[model samples]
Target: MEFFAVLIAWGAVQFWGSGAIVQSDDWFVALRRSLRKINGAVPRLLLTLSPLLLVALVLFLLGPILFGLPAFIISVVILLYSLGRGDFHIQLRLYLNSWQRGDLEGARRHGEYFDPELRTGAENALQLHQAVRKGVFYHGFERWFAVVFWFFLAGPVFALAYRLLFLIARHEDSEQRERDMAFQGLYYFEYLPARLLGFAFALIGHFDRCFPVWRQLSVAELPSDDYLDQLGATCLPGVSAEEAQDDSAFLQRASDELQAAQQMLSRSLLCWVGVMALIELF
Candidate 1:
């Protein structure tokens, strides 16, 4: 049932591109606002997690109904809702269009949408481009791989929890302390999945070059973004520091690298699905 839920949800996301109807966060924003009126950290935290609790309660109540058919349907809905909020491929296309046209400023502006922090840093076009590349890889991991990982490991509950924590951590109006705590929770949730995704990158990419980096970082406390950046750079076919140093063709090379990164991400996801199918079979 879990396998079928994942398969159906993956197909639905591909067909609908972002699944906006199920991915809406207006309710979350409202819930957060109401929770803010409560005193005490514990109470606020419990209120914040009430949605997840409600989901768990519903699944529990539905578990035995019609041989679990209703639960399966609910699982599919949760999985779809837990997916990343935006159309990543479209965003990548816009960034690439600006980049390939030799519009450095325009590309940087597009890149800022990927990582808002890019607005403050990235002294030059090269630096900005590199930051954008890292952003691309990180977004792919968090938006897809991480969600799928939790869903496969536990169920819809963990998947929803991961997405909720991500939203809290990234919420602009969230209190600093609340965001910090959410980030801490995210780190714990992401650690294992990040490593697993890195391993998948090694298998589907340049294994000889990427495997060593993956193994080396397995025990390190490196954040998921930096960890994926290191492994992704090593795995991509034509990516190298020297390519970025070339002034005349750097933009073209960066564009190619970005495309390669996207391909690697796709292949890694396929690899995971194949593995899961095998597991379901056996």
Candidate 2:
């Protein structure tokens, strides 16, 4: 039943695209406002999220009474909502088109949509390519892997909670301590899922090359943005600086790398679905 719900949500994502339904930032705004009224970070987070959590809990409880359909529907809706608030593939396509057209400025501008800190000013095309690829992989982990993980681990309610925590960490602009607290909460929640996804990426991609890197990385390194960034790049087909014989070759290789990365991610996603289906069968 959970697997079916995931399949339904995945189909919806394919047919409608994740961007068709716009999830409002208004809730986050309200939560942030409410948090400001609180004294401590943990209290602030809890108070702001408690109501939604309660509502989600109520919905989950209704599932058994309603013959599991309600739970299934709730899972689908929450999974869709939790799969990031934007269209991941669309932005990647736009970035690729811009890069192929020799529009470095456009690529950088689009890249910022994924990561505001992306260093677009680098004259080295490879550097810019690496930065953008890193951003895409990290965001992919956040948007897709984390949501599906929590959904399977618990239920729709926890999935929704995870997404809320992620939004708080991503969108809230606050003092160092507050930001640190929010991010720490997100980091801890994502720790297991991220490693799992990294392992899957290795299995589905260049495993001999990717798995060793996955093994050698320390616990301290595993949870950071750099881990996924590096893992994704290494796991996918290699794109070397030597490939950049000229500007055109450099741009072409970068485009190829991005496409390869996208394909790798898609395969990893399929691997996840397959694993889930096997679990469901057994």
Candidate 3:
């Protein structure tokens, strides 16, 4: 039943579009903002969130008792909410389109949506392009893979908890200390799942190159972005020497690589679904 719910949520997002599935004006953001206004320590803020989470969990737990076949509804609602409210691919497409048109300003604007630290004047075209790719890869994990991983690991409650922690961690205006603490918490939450996704990327894409990259990395030493970038790069087939040298050809090649990376992500997701199905069967 959980697996079926996962499929339904994934299908809705894929066909109906995430924008339709997740409302723009969600209470989660408001709740985060209200907590930010508390002017307390990070621990205090986290403590404040605890009861809210507890209430949500209680409600979800009661769902099965109160209604018939509640798993599907609860799972779909949580999954839809946990996934990115906006369209990641649309953002990527906007960046790529602006980039191909030689509109650096437009490209940088859209690219910063993925990577807030991106600076328009700081990096060259190739560097900026690579940064966008890395941003997309990591953001995809946060928005999709991480949420799904938690859902299967526990249920809707843990999935919601993971996303709440993510929101608190990634909130823009929070104090540096609070943001750091939240991000650290999120890092721990995602530690194992990121590795799993990286391994999946290896299997679905270029096994030989990606697997070694996956195997060689120590969790203590590597940050998530570096791990994702190195493994994702390995999975992609490189452009020809001529394509690399020419400016227009280079942009085209980069676009293709980005598309290929997206495809790899999709395949890895399907692989997860297959494994979960097998587990259910046995």
Candidate 4:
């Protein structure tokens, strides 16, 4: 447990490091390629990789004190490994650049670089494009932030394992029905944690609105595809998860008429600030 302090420090460092280095190609390109290989591997291969990773993690964990390496060094090793996850942030950078470039469609296309399925689900080119950007906040907090935050709280191995588990969980194969089963399992894991992430944002941004909104949103029945979460994000000032998830038909009855999207934008930030304050408080 002596290394626990290292774990916490490493978590903070890696989180900040990610924000700093997300634009670099060195980590993202390598990670995407490596993950693609791992993705193509059989499940049994992952089982094999898991134990090996475990061994390596344990060695570094215990080696720091016993073998003369410093704890900070050990922590740096773990964070460096995480920073190898370059592909995860490439689309994000692209999305941001697109916005900077006034290329809304480019931004949208870049955002959904993850799954072809999600990319296809949007009603039209525009909806598909926009959904990707709207989805970024979720990915930013959930997949990147919370996953790392929780993992580093544990250890390098724990963090890597958690992410690997989710990556494996997200894989859909030949069986169409099985995909739903896997998705269900995925959400099950995310249920409480995702809410916790919201709480974290609440802690950071709005100390005033943090806990109460977190509690309220926790019980709120989110929409299909977690649309309720989006609506709740609309609970933030000026932010509109509703517009983010709007229909492509241009004429069809929009499914997310809960409120003005501009308001949703503002409210989402309020919620974010609130979650951040919550994190700071507790």
Candidate 5:
């Protein structure tokens, strides 16, 4: 199917988004960010926990074209859609701009983009400003990895899953139980694919360095299910539990500490794309 091929190409195109590229990705970013802004913790959590079958049904209706859509058109749409919207660039600019202008107050205001609950406080005070910001970060990951990863593996299935999972994650309240259920599934869904993505990163970047680090990440208590754990174990060497926990804890605290995690993530994205390019060339 051309659509399927389109999905593959879309998956392969992994340009690191610069300040200039933000406007182009405005669409997908906006769609997700808006849904997330409305959903918040309770709602989004519920959506993630929903039954996969139910999730499938919803995805089919909205993203049917993904499976059946023409490759050429699918290629165009995904690219158009991939451009981030929402407050991601706006917020990024705000924070960056504030820092550049020496606007501490401005920067603090911008920093509010992080999740309020998780943000609890800013020993820095800047990162804790908004839950939506976590939304921004989430959207960043969404467009950058989550959406495209699914698209390549199963075409429309990816689109449907992201939408369904995102919907569940976006809901709230008396429905907390439902939200929890939805949230739970997402944890399971990304289990295998996430590590596969990690492997792709290792392949593309400093393959030697990346592989060893990824092995370390496998044992590192970052998060996810047995599938993820198994994959990590198979691909990565091993790490002491205590040390991995410490690594996880440290990464969780300082966003700066996450530099390694970010590199790991980026390396994965770049490698996956580069590999796809190679496959297509062959």
Candidate 6:
């Protein structure tokens, strides 16, 4: 039932993309604002999680209804809502189109939509695109892989909890202490799933290249984004500084790398779904 719920939710997202009907955080923002008026950390945290608690309570009540169909429907809805909040493919396409046209400035502007820090950190078009590549990989993991991992392991409740924590950690207006605590929670939650996704990358991508990096970073306390970036870099063909010295060559190479990253993400996701299906079968 959980597996079917996942399949349905995944299919819906792919078919419809992340339209406002399927994804929105405005309610969460409003809830957080109300919760912030509370007096203490414990109360605020509990209030922040109150939605998940309510969800769990409702699922519990619905578990015995109509052979759990109601619970299943709610699970799919929550999972859909829990997915990464944007149309990643569209964003990637816009960025790539800009890169392909030799519009470095336009590409950088598109990349900035993904990582505002790219504006300051990237020295050239190649560097900016590479940073965007890493950002893409990280977003793929966070928005899809991590959410699916929690959903499969625990159910929709934990998946929703993970998303809630992510929002708190990344929210600009969140209190410093609240953000810190949320980040800490996410660190622990994402640890295993991130490594597992890296392992999947190794299997479906350049195994000889990716495996060693995966093994080395397996036990490290590095954040998920950094860890996945390192693994993703290894999975792709290397680009030398000399190859990127010229404008045309650098843009082409960066475009190739971004395409490679997209393919790797797609393959890894298919691999994960296959593994999940096999697990359910046997």
Q: Return the clash pairs for model 2, or none.
A: none
If both were scored by lDDT, which would come out higher, candidate 4 or candidate 6? 6
Clashes in predicted model 5: 38
lDDT by residue for model 3 over 1-282, one digit each (tens)? 667767888888888667255644356556666676566666645763584477466656767674635645756777778776578888888988998897878888889977888853436767777888898788878878888888887776777777777676766656777777777877787888789888898898778777777888635456677778778888898566687668888888888888888888778878887888898788
lDDT for each of the candidates?
0.85, 0.77, 0.75, 0.46, 0.47, 0.86
TM-scores of the models, in the given order?
A: 0.95, 0.91, 0.88, 0.53, 0.52, 0.95
Model 1: how far is 174 from its true place, Å?
Answer: 1.0
Cα lDDT tens digits, model 1, 143-163, are 888988889889999999999
Candidate 4 local lDDT, 122-189, one digit each (tens): 55544543365345445544444444454435555654444444444454421333344444544654
List ranges where model 4 is wrong by over 4 Å. 1-49, 64-75, 82-84, 87-90, 96-104, 114-118, 124-126, 171-189, 203-213, 219-232, 238-282
**TM-score of candidate 2 relative to the true fold:** 0.91
Tens digits of per-residue lDDT for model 6 on 136-201?
Answer: 888889888899999998999999999999988888778888888998899999999999889988
Candidate 1 structure, TM-score to reference: 0.95
Instruction: Provide backbone clash counts, one per model.
Output: 0, 0, 0, 38, 38, 0
Q: Per-residue error at 5 for model 5, in Å?
A: 6.6
Q: Which stretches of candidate 5 lie over 4 Å from their true place?
A: 1-87, 102-105, 112-120, 125-139, 197-210, 219-221, 224-268
Sliding window of 10 residues with minimal summed lDDT for model 3: 19-28
- Give the 10-residue window scoring lowest on summed lDDT in candidate 5: 250-259
Number of the candidate with higher lDDT, 1 or 2: 1
The lDDT, on a scale of 0 to 1, for candidate 4 is: 0.46
Error of 4 at 13 (Å): 8.2
**Model 6 lDDT on a 0 to 1 scale:** 0.86
> Where's the lowest-lDDT run of ten residues in candidate 2?
216-225
